[model samples]
Target: MTKRLQLADIGSALIVLFCLVPFYWMIVSALRHPADQFATTPFPLPVSFQNLAAAFAERNGFGRALLNSLIVAGTTTLLTLAIGITTAYVIARVEFRFKNVVLAIIVATSMFPGVTLLIPLLKLFVGLDWINTYQALVLPSLSFGLPLTVFNLTAFFKQLPSELEDAAQVDGCSQWQAFRAVILPLAMPGVFTSGIITFIAAWNEFIIALSLTNDQKMRTAPVITALFTGQYKFDQPFGTQMAAGVAVTVPLVIGALLFQRRIVDGLTAGALK
Candidate 1:
Protein backbone atom coordinates (compact mmCIF):
# COMPACT_ATOMS: atom_id res chain seq x y z
CA MET A 1 0.00 0.00 0.00
CA THR A 2 2.82 2.44 0.78
CA LYS A 3 4.47 1.62 -2.53
CA ARG A 4 1.22 2.22 -4.38
CA LEU A 5 0.69 5.52 -2.54
CA GLN A 6 4.21 6.69 -3.44
CA LEU A 7 3.63 5.77 -7.09
CA ALA A 8 0.32 7.63 -7.11
CA ASP A 9 1.95 10.72 -5.59
CA ILE A 10 4.71 10.64 -8.17
CA GLY A 11 2.16 10.22 -10.97
CA SER A 12 0.05 13.09 -9.73
CA ALA A 13 3.10 15.32 -9.42
CA LEU A 14 4.16 14.48 -12.97
CA ILE A 15 0.69 15.20 -14.31
CA VAL A 16 0.54 18.54 -12.53
CA LEU A 17 4.03 19.48 -13.78
CA PHE A 18 3.03 18.56 -17.35
CA CYS A 19 0.03 20.84 -17.17
CA LEU A 20 1.80 23.72 -15.43
CA VAL A 21 5.03 23.82 -17.44
CA PRO A 22 3.53 25.79 -20.31
CA PHE A 23 1.93 28.27 -17.92
CA TYR A 24 5.22 28.70 -16.07
CA TRP A 25 6.99 29.26 -19.40
CA MET A 26 4.44 31.88 -20.32
CA ILE A 27 5.06 33.73 -17.05
CA VAL A 28 8.82 33.48 -17.45
CA SER A 29 8.65 34.76 -21.02
CA ALA A 30 6.29 37.55 -20.03
CA LEU A 31 8.70 38.76 -17.37
CA ARG A 32 11.82 38.52 -19.59
CA HIS A 33 13.17 41.54 -21.38
CA PRO A 34 11.83 41.74 -24.91
CA ALA A 35 15.37 41.49 -26.32
CA ASP A 36 16.02 38.32 -24.32
CA GLN A 37 12.61 36.71 -24.83
CA PHE A 38 13.98 34.03 -27.16
CA ALA A 39 16.74 32.94 -24.75
CA THR A 40 16.74 29.17 -24.16
CA THR A 41 16.93 29.67 -20.41
CA PRO A 42 13.60 28.78 -18.76
CA PHE A 43 13.93 31.52 -16.17
CA PRO A 44 14.01 35.26 -16.65
CA LEU A 45 17.47 36.55 -15.61
CA PRO A 46 16.25 40.04 -14.84
CA VAL A 47 12.50 40.42 -14.61
CA SER A 48 10.92 43.25 -16.58
CA PHE A 49 7.38 44.56 -16.71
CA GLN A 50 7.81 45.98 -20.21
CA ASN A 51 5.98 43.05 -21.84
CA LEU A 52 3.05 43.47 -19.45
CA ALA A 53 3.07 47.21 -20.09
CA ALA A 54 3.03 46.63 -23.83
CA ALA A 55 0.17 44.16 -23.54
CA PHE A 56 -1.95 46.75 -21.75
CA ALA A 57 -0.75 49.69 -23.84
CA GLU A 58 -3.48 52.25 -24.39
CA ARG A 59 -3.49 51.77 -28.14
CA ASN A 60 -3.97 48.01 -27.79
CA GLY A 61 -7.30 48.46 -26.00
CA PHE A 62 -6.57 45.38 -23.85
CA GLY A 63 -8.02 47.04 -20.75
CA ARG A 64 -11.28 47.77 -22.52
CA ALA A 65 -11.28 44.27 -23.91
CA LEU A 66 -10.78 42.82 -20.42
CA LEU A 67 -13.67 44.89 -19.10
CA ASN A 68 -15.84 43.81 -22.02
CA SER A 69 -15.03 40.17 -21.29
CA LEU A 70 -15.92 40.67 -17.63
CA ILE A 71 -19.25 42.29 -18.50
CA VAL A 72 -20.25 39.70 -21.08
CA ALA A 73 -19.02 36.69 -19.14
CA GLY A 74 -20.47 37.89 -15.82
CA THR A 75 -23.84 38.63 -17.38
CA THR A 76 -23.92 35.30 -19.19
CA THR A 77 -23.14 33.42 -15.95
CA LEU A 78 -25.87 35.23 -14.04
CA LEU A 79 -28.53 34.77 -16.70
CA THR A 80 -27.61 31.16 -17.39
CA LEU A 81 -27.69 30.28 -13.68
CA ALA A 82 -30.99 32.06 -13.02
CA ILE A 83 -32.75 30.32 -15.88
CA GLY A 84 -30.91 27.06 -15.27
CA ILE A 85 -31.97 26.91 -11.61
CA THR A 86 -35.67 27.15 -12.46
CA THR A 87 -35.48 24.96 -15.54
CA ALA A 88 -33.44 22.34 -13.72
CA TYR A 89 -35.86 22.34 -10.78
CA VAL A 90 -38.81 21.66 -13.01
CA ILE A 91 -37.04 19.01 -15.07
CA ALA A 92 -35.76 17.26 -11.96
CA ARG A 93 -38.92 17.37 -9.85
CA VAL A 94 -41.84 17.71 -12.22
CA GLU A 95 -42.98 14.82 -14.42
CA PHE A 96 -43.80 16.10 -17.85
CA ARG A 97 -44.34 14.69 -21.34
CA PHE A 98 -41.20 13.79 -23.29
CA LYS A 99 -39.03 14.75 -20.31
CA ASN A 100 -36.09 12.60 -21.31
CA VAL A 101 -36.39 13.92 -24.85
CA VAL A 102 -36.30 17.46 -23.52
CA LEU A 103 -33.18 16.77 -21.45
CA ALA A 104 -31.52 15.00 -24.38
CA ILE A 105 -32.33 17.89 -26.70
CA ILE A 106 -30.78 20.39 -24.30
CA VAL A 107 -27.61 18.27 -24.12
CA ALA A 108 -27.65 17.85 -27.91
CA THR A 109 -27.71 21.62 -28.46
CA SER A 110 -24.48 21.90 -26.48
CA MET A 111 -22.85 19.34 -28.77
CA PHE A 112 -23.52 21.40 -31.91
CA PRO A 113 -20.48 23.11 -33.35
CA GLY A 114 -20.56 26.77 -32.38
CA VAL A 115 -18.86 27.82 -35.61
CA THR A 116 -21.76 26.60 -37.74
CA LEU A 117 -24.14 29.06 -36.08
CA LEU A 118 -21.88 32.11 -36.43
CA ILE A 119 -22.94 33.29 -39.86
CA PRO A 120 -26.66 33.11 -39.18
CA LEU A 121 -26.19 34.72 -35.79
CA LEU A 122 -24.04 37.45 -37.31
CA LYS A 123 -26.72 38.17 -39.87
CA LEU A 124 -29.39 38.26 -37.18
CA PHE A 125 -27.30 40.61 -35.05
CA VAL A 126 -26.73 42.80 -38.07
CA GLY A 127 -30.47 43.01 -38.65
CA LEU A 128 -31.06 43.98 -35.04
CA ASP A 129 -28.15 46.49 -35.13
CA TRP A 130 -26.63 44.71 -32.14
CA ILE A 131 -23.18 44.55 -33.70
CA ASN A 132 -20.43 45.72 -31.34
CA THR A 133 -22.79 45.54 -28.37
CA TYR A 134 -22.68 43.45 -25.15
CA GLN A 135 -25.95 41.77 -26.15
CA ALA A 136 -24.41 40.53 -29.37
CA LEU A 137 -21.73 38.73 -27.40
CA VAL A 138 -23.96 37.54 -24.55
CA LEU A 139 -26.77 36.21 -26.75
CA PRO A 140 -24.66 33.90 -28.88
CA SER A 141 -22.77 32.66 -25.82
CA LEU A 142 -26.09 31.67 -24.26
CA SER A 143 -26.64 29.18 -27.07
CA PHE A 144 -23.79 27.09 -25.66
CA GLY A 145 -23.85 28.16 -21.98
CA LEU A 146 -27.54 27.55 -21.21
CA PRO A 147 -27.59 23.93 -22.30
CA LEU A 148 -24.68 22.86 -20.10
CA THR A 149 -26.05 24.87 -17.20
CA VAL A 150 -29.38 23.10 -17.49
CA PHE A 151 -27.81 19.67 -17.84
CA ASN A 152 -25.52 20.01 -14.80
CA LEU A 153 -28.06 21.74 -12.60
CA THR A 154 -30.75 19.23 -13.56
CA ALA A 155 -28.53 16.32 -12.51
CA PHE A 156 -27.67 18.09 -9.27
CA PHE A 157 -31.30 18.85 -8.49
CA LYS A 158 -32.24 15.24 -9.12
CA GLN A 159 -29.65 14.11 -6.59
CA LEU A 160 -31.05 16.44 -3.94
CA PRO A 161 -33.38 14.97 -1.31
CA SER A 162 -36.99 15.70 -2.21
CA GLU A 163 -37.80 15.79 1.50
CA LEU A 164 -36.30 19.28 1.74
CA GLU A 165 -38.81 20.68 -0.71
CA ASP A 166 -41.65 18.68 0.89
CA ALA A 167 -40.74 19.99 4.32
CA ALA A 168 -40.60 23.55 3.01
CA GLN A 169 -44.04 23.13 1.41
CA VAL A 170 -45.49 21.70 4.61
CA ASP A 171 -44.44 24.94 6.31
CA GLY A 172 -46.78 26.78 3.88
CA CYS A 173 -44.09 27.62 1.32
CA SER A 174 -45.31 27.82 -2.25
CA GLN A 175 -43.58 25.71 -4.87
CA TRP A 176 -41.56 28.70 -5.99
CA GLN A 177 -40.75 29.62 -2.41
CA ALA A 178 -39.76 26.07 -1.61
CA PHE A 179 -37.47 25.96 -4.60
CA ARG A 180 -36.02 29.38 -3.91
CA ALA A 181 -35.52 28.78 -0.21
CA VAL A 182 -34.89 25.06 0.22
CA ILE A 183 -33.65 23.76 -3.09
CA LEU A 184 -31.39 26.59 -4.20
CA PRO A 185 -29.10 26.49 -1.15
CA LEU A 186 -28.55 22.76 -1.55
CA ALA A 187 -27.85 23.14 -5.26
CA MET A 188 -25.25 25.93 -4.87
CA PRO A 189 -22.29 23.69 -5.63
CA GLY A 190 -23.84 22.76 -8.95
CA VAL A 191 -24.75 26.37 -9.60
CA PHE A 192 -21.18 27.50 -8.90
CA THR A 193 -19.82 24.78 -11.15
CA SER A 194 -22.16 25.69 -13.99
CA GLY A 195 -21.56 29.41 -13.52
CA ILE A 196 -17.78 29.00 -13.55
CA ILE A 197 -17.90 26.86 -16.68
CA THR A 198 -20.19 29.35 -18.42
CA PHE A 199 -17.99 32.27 -17.40
CA ILE A 200 -14.85 30.57 -18.71
CA ALA A 201 -16.54 29.66 -21.99
CA ALA A 202 -17.75 33.20 -22.54
CA TRP A 203 -14.39 34.65 -21.52
CA ASN A 204 -12.39 32.44 -23.87
CA GLU A 205 -14.81 32.55 -26.81
CA PHE A 206 -13.06 34.10 -29.79
CA ILE A 207 -14.59 33.33 -33.21
CA ILE A 208 -18.08 34.50 -32.33
CA ALA A 209 -16.83 37.65 -30.61
CA LEU A 210 -14.57 38.37 -33.58
CA SER A 211 -17.33 37.77 -36.12
CA LEU A 212 -19.92 39.84 -34.29
CA THR A 213 -18.00 42.85 -33.01
CA ASN A 214 -16.30 44.89 -35.68
CA ASP A 215 -15.00 47.59 -33.33
CA GLN A 216 -11.88 47.16 -31.24
CA LYS A 217 -13.52 49.02 -28.37
CA MET A 218 -16.06 46.25 -27.95
CA ARG A 219 -13.63 43.37 -28.38
CA THR A 220 -13.05 40.87 -25.57
CA ALA A 221 -9.63 39.94 -24.14
CA PRO A 222 -9.35 36.69 -26.10
CA VAL A 223 -10.12 38.47 -29.36
CA ILE A 224 -7.78 41.38 -28.67
CA THR A 225 -5.03 39.07 -27.43
CA ALA A 226 -5.18 37.13 -30.69
CA LEU A 227 -4.86 40.35 -32.67
CA PHE A 228 -1.82 41.47 -30.65
CA THR A 229 0.95 42.61 -33.01
CA GLY A 230 4.06 44.43 -31.88
CA GLN A 231 5.09 47.99 -32.78
CA TYR A 232 6.52 46.94 -36.16
CA LYS A 233 5.26 44.91 -39.08
CA PHE A 234 5.85 41.09 -38.90
CA ASP A 235 6.79 41.48 -35.24
CA GLN A 236 5.14 38.72 -33.19
CA PRO A 237 6.03 40.21 -29.75
CA PHE A 238 6.17 36.82 -28.09
CA GLY A 239 6.81 38.41 -24.69
CA THR A 240 3.81 40.70 -24.97
CA GLN A 241 1.60 37.85 -26.10
CA MET A 242 2.80 35.80 -23.16
CA ALA A 243 1.95 38.69 -20.85
CA ALA A 244 -1.51 38.90 -22.32
CA GLY A 245 -1.92 35.15 -21.88
CA VAL A 246 -0.95 35.42 -18.21
CA ALA A 247 -3.34 38.32 -17.76
CA VAL A 248 -6.18 36.43 -19.39
CA THR A 249 -5.42 33.27 -17.41
CA VAL A 250 -5.18 34.69 -13.87
CA PRO A 251 -8.89 35.20 -13.21
CA LEU A 252 -9.74 31.69 -14.41
CA VAL A 253 -7.01 30.18 -12.24
CA ILE A 254 -8.21 32.09 -9.22
CA GLY A 255 -11.81 31.06 -9.80
CA ALA A 256 -10.92 27.40 -10.21
CA LEU A 257 -8.80 27.43 -7.05
CA LEU A 258 -11.63 28.98 -5.08
CA PHE A 259 -14.37 26.64 -6.28
CA GLN A 260 -12.59 23.44 -7.29
CA ARG A 261 -14.24 21.39 -4.57
CA ARG A 262 -17.67 22.62 -5.58
CA ILE A 263 -16.93 21.83 -9.23
CA VAL A 264 -15.89 18.30 -8.34
CA ASP A 265 -18.95 17.74 -6.19
CA GLY A 266 -21.23 19.14 -8.86
CA LEU A 267 -19.84 16.84 -11.52
CA THR A 268 -20.14 13.76 -9.30
CA ALA A 269 -23.41 14.67 -7.58
CA GLY A 270 -25.80 12.46 -9.51
CA ALA A 271 -23.36 9.75 -10.53
CA LEU A 272 -24.55 7.32 -7.85
CA LYS A 273 -28.21 8.30 -8.17
Candidate 2:
Protein backbone atom coordinates (compact mmCIF):
# COMPACT_ATOMS: atom_id res chain seq x y z
CA MET A 1 0.00 0.00 0.00
CA THR A 2 1.13 3.54 -0.76
CA LYS A 3 1.82 5.87 2.15
CA ARG A 4 -0.83 8.52 2.55
CA LEU A 5 0.14 12.18 2.76
CA GLN A 6 -0.23 13.69 6.21
CA LEU A 7 -1.39 17.20 7.18
CA ALA A 8 2.22 18.18 7.80
CA ASP A 9 3.15 17.01 4.33
CA ILE A 10 0.28 19.01 2.79
CA GLY A 11 1.28 22.10 4.74
CA SER A 12 4.90 21.76 3.62
CA ALA A 13 3.83 21.38 0.02
CA LEU A 14 1.69 24.52 0.31
CA ILE A 15 4.54 26.48 1.84
CA VAL A 16 6.96 25.42 -0.88
CA LEU A 17 4.44 26.33 -3.59
CA PHE A 18 3.83 29.72 -1.98
CA CYS A 19 7.55 30.42 -1.91
CA LEU A 20 8.07 29.40 -5.52
CA VAL A 21 5.23 31.56 -6.90
CA PRO A 22 7.38 34.64 -7.34
CA PHE A 23 10.22 32.75 -9.07
CA TYR A 24 7.68 31.10 -11.36
CA TRP A 25 6.14 34.47 -12.18
CA MET A 26 9.55 35.99 -12.76
CA ILE A 27 10.49 33.25 -15.24
CA VAL A 28 7.16 33.55 -17.04
CA SER A 29 7.31 37.33 -17.27
CA ALA A 30 10.89 37.14 -18.51
CA LEU A 31 10.04 34.71 -21.31
CA ARG A 32 6.77 36.33 -22.43
CA HIS A 33 6.56 37.95 -25.89
CA PRO A 34 6.65 41.75 -25.75
CA ALA A 35 3.12 42.13 -27.16
CA ASP A 36 1.71 39.66 -24.61
CA GLN A 37 4.17 40.26 -21.80
CA PHE A 38 1.43 41.36 -19.46
CA ALA A 39 -0.47 38.08 -19.64
CA THR A 40 -0.88 36.24 -16.29
CA THR A 41 -0.65 32.74 -17.67
CA PRO A 42 1.12 30.14 -15.48
CA PHE A 43 3.76 29.40 -18.12
CA PRO A 44 5.04 31.66 -20.85
CA LEU A 45 3.70 30.62 -24.30
CA PRO A 46 5.14 31.64 -27.65
CA VAL A 47 8.12 32.76 -25.61
CA SER A 48 10.60 35.32 -26.86
CA PHE A 49 14.29 35.97 -26.13
CA GLN A 50 14.04 39.73 -26.68
CA ASN A 51 13.80 40.48 -22.96
CA LEU A 52 16.71 38.17 -22.11
CA ALA A 53 18.70 39.79 -24.88
CA ALA A 54 17.77 43.19 -23.54
CA ALA A 55 18.98 42.27 -20.06
CA PHE A 56 22.48 41.53 -21.39
CA ALA A 57 22.50 44.43 -23.85
CA GLU A 58 25.48 46.79 -23.56
CA ARG A 59 23.15 49.71 -22.95
CA ASN A 60 21.63 47.91 -19.95
CA GLY A 61 25.03 47.28 -18.31
CA PHE A 62 23.51 44.34 -16.41
CA GLY A 63 26.01 41.97 -18.00
CA ARG A 64 28.95 44.01 -16.78
CA ALA A 65 27.34 44.28 -13.37
CA LEU A 66 27.18 40.48 -13.20
CA LEU A 67 30.91 40.28 -13.78
CA ASN A 68 31.60 42.92 -11.13
CA SER A 69 29.40 41.07 -8.64
CA LEU A 70 31.18 37.78 -9.41
CA ILE A 71 34.59 39.30 -8.78
CA VAL A 72 33.57 40.97 -5.51
CA ALA A 73 31.72 37.95 -4.17
CA GLY A 74 34.44 35.52 -5.20
CA THR A 75 37.20 37.54 -3.59
CA THR A 76 35.18 38.05 -0.43
CA THR A 77 34.39 34.32 -0.12
CA LEU A 78 38.00 33.26 -0.52
CA LEU A 79 39.26 35.85 1.93
CA THR A 80 36.60 35.06 4.50
CA LEU A 81 37.39 31.35 4.35
CA ALA A 82 41.18 31.71 4.42
CA ILE A 83 41.22 34.05 7.40
CA GLY A 84 38.16 32.63 9.10
CA ILE A 85 39.24 28.98 8.99
CA THR A 86 42.60 29.68 10.63
CA THR A 87 41.06 32.00 13.21
CA ALA A 88 38.38 29.45 13.98
CA TYR A 89 40.88 26.63 14.25
CA VAL A 90 43.05 28.56 16.66
CA ILE A 91 40.07 29.43 18.83
CA ALA A 92 38.79 25.88 18.76
CA ARG A 93 42.04 24.01 19.33
CA VAL A 94 44.61 26.20 21.04
CA GLU A 95 43.90 27.50 24.50
CA PHE A 96 44.71 31.16 24.98
CA ARG A 97 44.02 33.96 27.45
CA PHE A 98 40.61 35.60 27.17
CA LYS A 99 39.64 32.93 24.66
CA ASN A 100 35.91 33.02 25.36
CA VAL A 101 36.01 36.77 25.74
CA VAL A 102 37.66 37.24 22.35
CA LEU A 103 35.32 34.81 20.59
CA ALA A 104 32.34 36.55 22.20
CA ILE A 105 33.57 39.94 21.08
CA ILE A 106 34.18 38.73 17.56
CA VAL A 107 30.71 37.23 17.24
CA ALA A 108 29.01 40.18 18.95
CA THR A 109 30.32 42.59 16.33
CA SER A 110 28.55 40.67 13.58
CA MET A 111 25.24 41.45 15.33
CA PHE A 112 25.65 45.17 14.72
CA PRO A 113 23.70 46.27 11.69
CA GLY A 114 25.77 46.62 8.52
CA VAL A 115 23.86 49.84 7.74
CA THR A 116 25.56 51.43 10.73
CA LEU A 117 28.87 51.08 8.92
CA LEU A 118 27.66 52.60 5.64
CA ILE A 119 28.20 56.30 6.24
CA PRO A 120 31.45 55.70 8.11
CA LEU A 121 32.84 53.40 5.42
CA LEU A 122 31.74 55.69 2.62
CA LYS A 123 33.45 58.63 4.29
CA LEU A 124 36.66 56.66 4.91
CA PHE A 125 36.76 55.36 1.36
CA VAL A 126 36.21 58.85 -0.04
CA GLY A 127 39.14 60.14 2.00
CA LEU A 128 41.31 57.32 0.63
CA ASP A 129 39.82 57.81 -2.83
CA TRP A 130 38.80 54.15 -2.81
CA ILE A 131 35.24 54.56 -4.01
CA ASN A 132 34.12 52.17 -6.78
CA THR A 133 37.15 49.97 -6.08
CA TYR A 134 36.73 46.20 -5.53
CA GLN A 135 38.58 46.38 -2.18
CA ALA A 136 36.05 48.87 -0.82
CA LEU A 137 33.26 46.37 -1.44
CA VAL A 138 35.19 43.23 -0.53
CA LEU A 139 36.74 44.63 2.66
CA PRO A 140 33.51 45.75 4.27
CA SER A 141 31.85 42.50 3.31
CA LEU A 142 34.78 40.69 4.97
CA SER A 143 34.40 42.73 8.14
CA PHE A 144 30.84 41.49 8.45
CA GLY A 145 31.27 38.07 6.79
CA LEU A 146 34.40 36.92 8.62
CA PRO A 147 32.86 36.86 12.08
CA LEU A 148 30.10 34.46 11.08
CA THR A 149 32.55 32.26 9.26
CA VAL A 150 34.73 32.13 12.35
CA PHE A 151 31.83 31.46 14.68
CA ASN A 152 30.50 28.63 12.50
CA LEU A 153 33.78 26.92 11.69
CA THR A 154 34.94 27.26 15.29
CA ALA A 155 32.01 25.19 16.45
CA PHE A 156 32.64 22.69 13.68
CA PHE A 157 36.31 22.42 14.51
CA LYS A 158 35.59 21.94 18.20
CA GLN A 159 33.35 18.96 17.52
CA LEU A 160 36.04 17.23 15.48
CA PRO A 161 38.16 14.77 17.49
CA SER A 162 41.53 16.24 18.34
CA GLU A 163 42.93 12.71 18.27
CA LEU A 164 42.85 12.91 14.47
CA GLU A 165 45.38 15.69 14.56
CA ASP A 166 47.36 13.75 17.17
CA ALA A 167 47.59 10.79 14.80
CA ALA A 168 48.89 12.97 11.96
CA GLN A 169 51.53 14.54 14.22
CA VAL A 170 52.59 11.07 15.36
CA ASP A 171 53.41 10.36 11.71
CA GLY A 172 56.15 13.09 11.71
CA CYS A 173 53.83 15.83 10.43
CA SER A 174 54.29 19.29 11.92
CA GLN A 175 51.32 20.87 13.67
CA TRP A 176 50.62 23.11 10.67
CA GLN A 177 51.05 20.21 8.28
CA ALA A 178 48.65 18.02 10.28
CA PHE A 179 45.94 20.69 10.19
CA ARG A 180 46.60 21.29 6.50
CA ALA A 181 46.38 17.65 5.55
CA VAL A 182 44.09 16.12 8.15
CA ILE A 183 41.72 18.54 9.88
CA LEU A 184 41.06 20.95 7.00
CA PRO A 185 40.12 18.29 4.49
CA LEU A 186 37.70 16.67 6.94
CA ALA A 187 36.19 20.08 7.64
CA MET A 188 35.11 20.54 4.02
CA PRO A 189 31.39 20.50 4.89
CA GLY A 190 31.67 23.40 7.29
CA VAL A 191 33.95 25.27 4.91
CA PHE A 192 31.62 24.72 2.00
CA THR A 193 28.66 25.92 4.05
CA SER A 194 30.45 29.06 5.14
CA GLY A 195 31.76 29.82 1.64
CA ILE A 196 28.37 29.54 -0.05
CA ILE A 197 26.64 31.64 2.61
CA THR A 198 29.30 34.36 2.47
CA PHE A 199 29.14 34.42 -1.32
CA ILE A 200 25.35 34.77 -1.43
CA ALA A 201 25.43 37.49 1.21
CA ALA A 202 28.04 39.42 -0.75
CA TRP A 203 26.33 38.81 -4.08
CA ASN A 204 22.87 40.03 -3.00
CA GLU A 205 24.19 43.25 -1.45
CA PHE A 206 23.01 46.40 -3.31
CA ILE A 207 22.87 49.43 -1.00
CA ILE A 208 26.65 49.48 -0.36
CA ALA A 209 27.35 48.92 -4.04
CA LEU A 210 24.94 51.67 -5.05
CA SER A 211 26.38 54.15 -2.56
CA LEU A 212 30.02 53.34 -3.24
CA THR A 213 29.99 53.32 -7.03
CA ASN A 214 28.85 56.33 -9.05
CA ASP A 215 30.01 54.72 -12.30
CA GLN A 216 27.56 52.43 -14.05
CA LYS A 217 30.38 50.10 -15.09
CA MET A 218 31.42 49.65 -11.46
CA ARG A 219 27.93 48.78 -10.19
CA THR A 220 26.62 45.30 -9.32
CA ALA A 221 23.87 43.25 -10.99
CA PRO A 222 21.14 44.25 -8.57
CA VAL A 223 22.03 47.90 -8.86
CA ILE A 224 21.92 47.68 -12.63
CA THR A 225 18.57 45.93 -12.41
CA ALA A 226 17.31 48.82 -10.29
CA LEU A 227 18.60 51.18 -12.98
CA PHE A 228 16.40 49.46 -15.54
CA THR A 229 13.34 50.48 -13.55
CA GLY A 230 14.34 54.16 -13.32
CA GLN A 231 15.11 54.64 -16.99
CA TYR A 232 12.28 56.30 -18.99
CA LYS A 233 13.75 54.89 -22.18
CA PHE A 234 11.54 51.86 -21.81
CA ASP A 235 7.83 52.15 -21.13
CA GLN A 236 6.15 49.13 -19.49
CA PRO A 237 9.48 47.72 -18.46
CA PHE A 238 8.10 44.70 -16.54
CA GLY A 239 9.41 42.21 -19.09
CA THR A 240 12.88 43.70 -19.14
CA GLN A 241 12.96 44.07 -15.36
CA MET A 242 11.96 40.44 -14.88
CA ALA A 243 14.55 39.44 -17.40
CA ALA A 244 17.18 41.26 -15.38
CA GLY A 245 16.01 39.52 -12.23
CA VAL A 246 16.37 36.13 -13.93
CA ALA A 247 19.85 36.90 -15.11
CA VAL A 248 20.86 38.05 -11.63
CA THR A 249 19.24 35.16 -9.74
CA VAL A 250 19.85 32.15 -11.99
CA PRO A 251 23.59 31.65 -11.34
CA LEU A 252 23.21 31.62 -7.57
CA VAL A 253 20.29 29.25 -7.98
CA ILE A 254 22.42 26.90 -10.06
CA GLY A 255 25.25 27.01 -7.50
CA ALA A 256 22.91 26.16 -4.66
CA LEU A 257 21.37 23.29 -6.61
CA LEU A 258 24.78 21.85 -7.45
CA PHE A 259 26.10 21.98 -3.88
CA GLN A 260 22.89 21.15 -2.03
CA ARG A 261 24.19 17.79 -0.91
CA ARG A 262 27.38 19.35 0.42
CA ILE A 263 25.31 21.93 2.27
CA VAL A 264 23.37 19.16 3.98
CA ASP A 265 26.62 17.46 4.87
CA GLY A 266 27.98 20.67 6.34
CA LEU A 267 24.97 21.19 8.52
CA THR A 268 25.23 17.63 9.81
CA ALA A 269 29.00 17.44 10.20
CA GLY A 270 30.41 15.62 13.26
CA ALA A 271 27.13 13.80 13.70
CA LEU A 272 28.61 10.44 12.66
CA LYS A 273 32.39 10.94 13.01
Give the per-residue lDDT of model 2 (tens digit) for 77-109: 999999999999999999999999999999998
Clashes of each: 0, 0
Cα lDDT of model 1 by residue, 166-213, tens digit: 999999999889988888888887888888899999999999999998
Model 2 scores a C-alpha lDDT of: 0.89
Evaluate model 1: give its TM-score.
0.95
Q: Give each model's whole-structure lDDT.
A: 0.90, 0.89
Residue 134 accuracy (lDDT) in model 2? 93
Best by TM-score: 1
Give the clashing residue pairs of candidate 1, or none: none
Candidate 2 wrongly placed segments (more than 4 Å): 1-5, 229-231, 234-236, 270-273
